[model samples]
Target: MSRLIRGVGAVLLAGAVLGGCATHPNSEQALQQAGGDFQKVKEDANVLRFAPKDVIRAGESLARADRLSTYWGSGADVEHYAYLSRRYSAIAREHTEQGLNAERGARLELERQRLQLALRESKLSSVQQQGKWLEEQITSLATQTDRGLVMTLGDVLFDTGDAELKNSANRTVLKIVQFLQLNPKRVVRIEGYADNTGGEQENLRLSRDRAQSVADVLVDLGIDEKRIQVEGYGDQYPVEANASERGRAQNRRVEIVFSDAKGQLGAAR
Candidate 1:
């Protein structure tokens, strides 16, 4: 392809210039003699490419060419391969230098990529280990009976004056989501309780509203409404003494009670 040929020409031209730029002449005469040799060979009829014998000829030509190119602006008539001969030799010298530089760059780039891959693999392994440990913790929590979970929620789920689930109760909400999603056939109950600190009618209304709020959140989190029921346990079924702050806090909470209709998880047959 013409494109490929052009690309090759560009690379060769670059090598010649770069090679000459880096080379230092040991003696002025030696450099001039090499340049003179290239000048004489510029008239040669053969277009020799790079072979072992050709390399020797090219070297001889490059030295002379180098000398002639130095005198280009001195008003000498530009002969047809005079510039060619000089340029070609310079190109040959540049090729050697560029090849060495390219090899060194390739080696360093490969080393950098290897180190980067190693670091990424190490971090990925650590994250996978942490995920496994978290799964184990979830599994342990899943093995507990629903009543134990509800009892736990009673203490830590709400504050003394609030029916809102505490921040510490976030894990419970997540676990409930997981459980409901997994047991798609099971129905759940939301039972809200309030302490006797408020008036009887207000307490009942608050309990019902709070229970409805819990059910609303569950539904928003993808639980099916047909599988859930909400109820208010108003000032009744007290788990602890209403006189104490701790007991009142315990009483003011929501319970996610599982009532399996399909009995899928050993609750049926």
Candidate 2:
């Protein structure tokens, strides 16, 4: 009879311990809600790719909540852990959104830079075409020479022993003025030469006076004076021998040299 009584007492003690360890319904519900939220966020593509660490932390919080409910039953500690799990899930979602927004901003900036570069290229092409048209106009009036494009006015254009130009040379002067007006960026150099028939001093003075006469005409035609350079090369740099009248005639002339686009003139060959 004493053995039976002792066994009943042991059974009562075991039941009491089991009842103390059992979880309350409210604690179980809280754990389920936290776990569901974490799972839902973790499955999202952005969160999985960009916020993987945050999502992992949320899952760990949920596991901790579950352990607390199993060991301590319905308690404040379980609820606290459940709240932490839900907060971590929210943080993961927020980080994912921030990362996506940053990526979109970077793409927009790159597109803006591309458009600016294209616009600059278009403007440069237009400028190059305009320069080509100006070149064509110059070619019509001048002949290409070793030094650059040159326009020559023979001794017939000027009076003998005088620096004044003849009336017949008006057309040539007009064409030159029109070209200069069209291309304001171009620079002109007026060079004068004389035949060997004259004395050295007299020939040099005459050549210089003729070059100055042409320079004055250009300035009067609305071309800037700064764009013209004048020089006299008496009986020097002759194109033909002075032994014949024809050769001497060719040597006594004025040459207008046009520089390249950058205002650079090549040396005479």
- Per-candidate Cα lDDT values, in order, are 0.60, 0.79
Best by TM-score: 2
Candidate with the greatest lDDT versus the true structure:
2
Q: For residues 1-269, what per-residue lDDT tens digits would candidate 1 score against the true structure? A: 99999998876665455433223332333444546655444443332322224445556455454544344232122232234445555555455456557778999999999999999999978766665564455445543464422313466665544656666766767767666665567676677888888888888877777778777777888988887777787888787898888888778877665653373322211
Tens digits of lDDT, candidate 2, 1-269 = 99999998876565445432344556667777898989889789988988898898889888887777655444566777888998999999899999998999899889889989999999878766765665675587679988899988875776546677777777888777776766677788998888887788888888788888888988988889988988888778888998988888777778899887677766643
Question: Which portions of model 1 show Cα errors greater than 4 Å?
Answer: 1-152, 261-269
Model 1 clashes, total count: 8
Where does candidate 2 stray beyond 4 Å?
1-33, 70-75, 105-113, 140-147, 151-256, 260-269
- RMSD, every candidate, angstroms: 15.4, 9.8
Task: Tell me which residue pairs clash in candidate 2.
Answer: none
